[model samples]
Target: MTAIPAVTLNNGVTIPQLGLGVFQIPDAETRAAVTTALEAGYRSIDTAAVYGNETGVGRALAASGLPRDELFVTTKLWITDLGRRAARDALRASLDRLGLDRVDLYLIHWPAPATDAYLDAWQGLEDLYAEGLARAIGVSNFLPEHLDRVVALGGTVPAVNQIELHPALQNRETAAAAAARGIATEAWSPLAQGAVLTEAPIVAAARAHGVTPAQVVLRWHLQQGRIVIPKSVTPARIAANLDVFGFDLTAAELTAIDALDRAGRTGPHPATFQG
Candidate 1:
């Protein structure tokens, strides 16, 4: 088991830099997957209300027997639930499903700019945090303008901004903006959704590093200082995602991965996001 690294949030909370993401895993499979990840030494778990598997994730956590403080749990509010009243109640529902009294991190899943409810939603989250339901609060898929709006609303700056970031879509400018505000940017599709596993450079790097292409790609994310949540339901792949601590990428090798950036994004664009 590789030792996952940690990063200090803007609020000084420590989070495992690499975590297991339960994005599309079904309820039936999520429990076993999270259990496998935990046994493989992953301490952070990322899920969302939109994922519809929080109950299974909660079951896995309870079954692990690890103390609550030893694990980092993150969940999000869906765009459909983006009002002050709905947002407040949404956290409660998510908590009930997860069987956790409070979450390590909670987020507004998307800006939903067209819906124009995020500002009040931010206020709702602020209230929830003040009332002690979330240890830290953040956003997902928020671009610079969206972040500025949240900051302007007089709430604590979001502790993180999770996005689709792989070598194919590095989002350096967005990342720098988050850094400027002391918000840690997290990568969701950190592996390019597995589409780049066969790229020539990644393949050669894999051979030279005596590691798999997936490992090389994940290492690039780590070296970039981006918090990454790579998901897999298979037990072996879950273990493989966590087994990234033994090697370090050379400066040139890191540069090679950087060169693969083509402004390719496998997920939604922030500019066009409705949520």
Candidate 2:
């Protein structure tokens, strides 16, 4: 098994650069998928309260018999669960469902700037971190402006900012903003939902390296220093996503992939997504 490199967050907690994402995966299949990834040497698993699969993920963790400290589990607070008290209760509920004492990272799933409650939600996360209920806390799908508000408030700096990122939607501005603040940028759709696999540059790079386009894209992300969570229920692909450690993309190859960025995002824009 390839050793997945770990990215150290702003809070000094380390997370596996590559992990399994349980987005859009049905509850019935989540456990099996998580089990397969664990058996393939994956130590990180990213899910969210809205995914409706935390119970399944918890079951797999229990069955794997892997020591608690060996896994990096992350989940997010939904938009509806904003505000200080609601956020705290939401995390407790999430913890109960995951059957874990603490999550490796907890995040405000979305800023929901329209509601103007993310800042309060952030405070709740700080309390969780301070209490050790969460090893680290951060936000997801947050734009630069949203992050600016949290930073100015001067609590805990977000350890990570996960967003809809892929080769086609590189999101350089958001990534750079997070990097400037020492927040690690995590790519949620690192493969562009299978849209980038057949791109001419990706295919050529894969052919040159004797690997699949998926691996090529994942390698591109790793080479760029971005943490990527590529979701897959297929056992082979789950294992293959973790196999990106062996290859390195050349500078030109990396640039070619970067050129594929159309500024096209597959998910909702954080600035306007109130839900």
Most accurate candidate by lDDT = 2
- Highest TM-score model number: 2
lDDT at position 234, candidate 1: 87
The TM-score of candidate 1 is 0.97
TM-score of each prediction: 0.97, 0.99
Q: Write the per-residue lDDT of candidate 2 for residues 136-240, one digit (tens) a residue.
A: 999999889888999999878999999999989989999999998989999998998999899999999999999999999999989989988999999999988
* Error at 117, model 2, angstroms: 0.3
lDDT of 2 at 260: 92
